[model samples]
Target: MNILVISGGPRKHGRTAIAARFIERTYGFHTVDLSIVDMPMYTGEEDQSSNPFVKSLRQSVLDADAVLLLSPEYHSAMSGALKNTLDFLSSTQFLYKSVGLIAMAGGGKGGINCLNNMRTVMRGVYANAIPRQLVLDPSVFDYDRDGLNREAAEQVDGLVEELKMYARIAKEVKEQQLI
Candidate 1:
């Protein structure tokens, strides 16, 4: 499947990017790091011709069978940069796509809020967010900076599996409609 993973943290080497890298390595999914993507703040007046980066990002979302969104919790929610990037996408861009969410937080409690907030936003975009989610504490990666903790890794595996399953179903349904 053509899966797209978006890392929403400003720090390229932060936990959010690390999780996205793991997903890319394990699944061979394409990843877009917001830190590296030259996206200006979405101002609701953007045209495809005016902003190449936003246009390409929108096309990536439209082309993906499934998407994995990794965000670092900031102030009990997703970072402003991620939210702004998402603002550039309309509901049609994400219609019926399967989405997996991973929320990393400085404190474990904030991750849950971030996940819930992401779910609501995904719904607005008409994306089917898998019920399985990963809520992580940054401290969990302290011991193994190169990898996730065992339990966190297992949860990420489950989330990926769920996204694959849902993406398959969505594709089948779309095919049937086309037929």
Candidate 2:
């Protein structure tokens, strides 16, 4: 499947980026690291469709068979950058698309809230977010800073498999509906 992983951390070398890179390297998935991209905050008052970054972001979502949102917990919620990026998109870009959620918690205890928040937004955009989500805490990196430990890697593997399965099922359903 053409999985698009969006790294929504503010820091380029943060935990979210590490997870994104690991997924890309292990699964050959495409990644959009938001920390390096200068995506203007979505104000809804301006038409950013013409903006190159916004256009690219929109196109990326449109081209993906599935999306994996990677975010770091911040004050019990997702980063503002991620929320703004999501605001630039609509149901047209995500409807029926399989989406996987992963949250990195700096405090080792706050990632679940971030995942919950992301799930709510995915619902609003009509994405078929898989039920198997992940919340990686500090413990996940205790054995490996650049990648997930053995246990966390297994969890991510399961989530990715579920995402791929759902993406295939959704694609088949859509094709059948057209016929």
Candidate 3:
């Protein structure tokens, strides 16, 4: 399956990027690091049809069978950059798509709030976001080795598998026009 992973951290090499890269390395999924891209705030007042970045972002979501959104917890929620990115999309890009969420915290807590916020946004965009989400903290990482601990790694695997399973079901139902 073609899985698109979006690293919603504002820093290119932040914890969210680390987790996205880990998943890419482990499962061979493609990743889009939003920090490197120029994502203008979505005002929805101007015509964005010619904006290449916006088009690419929408196309990426449209092409993926599943998506994973990784964000760093910011003040008990997801970063502004991530929220802005989501604003560029709507049900046209996400409806019926299976999505997975991962929230990272610099400290050893507060990732759950970020996950919950993202889930609510996914629902608004009509994404079939799976319930098996991840809340990661500093303790789960091993920056020296550029990887997560064994337990955390296993949890990531399960989350990815869950996304794939849900994506497959969604695909089948869509193909059969079962809604």
The clash count for each model shown is 0, 0, 0
Candidate 3: deviation at residue 74, Å? 0.2
Give the range of the ten consecutive residues with the poorest summed lDDT in model 1. Answer: 138-147
Tens-digit lDDT track of model 1 for 70-142: 8998887888888988888878789989999999988646688788888999999999999888887876574
How many angstroms is residue 42 displaced in model 3 relative to the true structure, after the best TM-score fit? 1.3
Q: Candidate 3: which pairs clash?
A: none
Models, CA RMSD each? 1.6, 1.4, 1.5
Candidate 2 accuracy as lDDT = 0.90
Cα-based lDDT for every prediction: 0.85, 0.90, 0.91
Q: What would the per-residue lDDT of candidate 2 be over residues 80-105, giving only the tens digit for each residue?
A: 98999999999989998999999998
Query: What's the lDDT for residue 116 in model 2?
Result: 94
Cα TM-score of candidate 2: 0.95
- Tell me how candidate 3 scores on lDDT: 0.91
Which pairs clash (backbone N, Cα, C closer than 3 Å) in model 2?
none
lDDT of 2 at 109: 69
